[model samples]
Target: MNASPIFHRLALLAPLLCLGFVSISCTGYQLQTGRPQALTHVKKISVPLFENKTLVPRGEILATNSVVDAITNDGTYHIATLHEADAVLEGTMETITYSQVRSTRLDTLRSEEMENTVTLHWQLLDASTRKILSTGKATGSSRFAIDANQQTARQNALPDALQRAATQVVGRLTDDF
Candidate 1:
């Protein structure tokens, strides 16, 4: 019946609605905020055979393969051969130093714990422009109880640690760019 109550309610809500709209509109234009822009220009990515400077064999290959898998699975970029892509990803393993030592019961012949650590350095670059997009190092470590032999424990833990580092490095390179 009376328009007074309706008008009062509308007046109270109008400013709040307007503010909400303005905030949404501002966020819509925020740079690099939404789904990644389609990698139109660099449709194809070339991952050269990574060089394994570590004492471990195929360390670089494993890291490179993981990166390629991430890019391919991302569905945004196509994997191209070394000479056929718009951008090339090259990486060199600067270091891979790890120690496997007893962590528990130092005085006792039978130790209760063991630890393993894997450290790696990596870089990502755009081949066409020769631009270094990102470069950093990542490390992964794991510990487990050992009954008798340390070598077996070290070997088993090393791969998993390396895998962790590889995934972290690749995810950083792919998602941030």
Candidate 2:
């Protein structure tokens, strides 16, 4: 019996597929995101309180602490004081705005969305040389609406906005992508 064209192709592919499986069974390498090579030399980092150019009270402190938390969560970089760091990450908060996103249709107008947004400029530098290795601007926002617990919603959203902004800054600093 003569083999059909489709059968012939399958016969050729079958051996290759078997060979691939055999190779994998014998030895293999798993894909992974290894340590960030760029940050390898950076043993410690100093993130001082960011410069707050806006009127948000304690905005600088919030931004600074959020960045510290992000880096600490990364577990690759050590957080150090400015005097004892390999790199210093300096950030400037350019502006922050809270705006009403929407208003209710009810007789007494109520805010449906309160958006908190922050824009920041950041730089990573060699602590000793003061050479800037990286710098850029990033913005992040978070929103809260009038809910059953208005007080809790307001309290959570503002800090969430700041935290989101700070996380983006950290990602920008370390991410190779």
The numbered model that scores best in lDDT is 2
- Superposed on all Cα atoms, model 2 deviates from the true structure by an RMSD in Å of 6.5
Task: Give the per-residue lDDT digits (tens) of candidate 2, residues 44-69.
Answer: 89998899898767778887888889
Worst 10 residues of 2 by lDDT: 31-40
Q: Which pairs of residues collide in model 1? A: none
Q: Which ranges of candidate 1 are over 4 A from the true structure?
A: 1-41, 73-76, 99-102, 106-111, 147-149
Candidate 1 yields a Cα-based lDDT of 0.66
What is the C-alpha lDDT profile of model 1 across 1-177, one tens digit per residue? Answer: 667988999999999999999898888564542222333356677877777777766777766776677666665567887677776767665565554456454566555665656666766556666776567776766776675775676666766676666666656655653
Candidate 2 ranges with C-alpha deviation above 4 Å? 1-38, 106-110, 147-155
Error of 2 at 19 (Å): 12
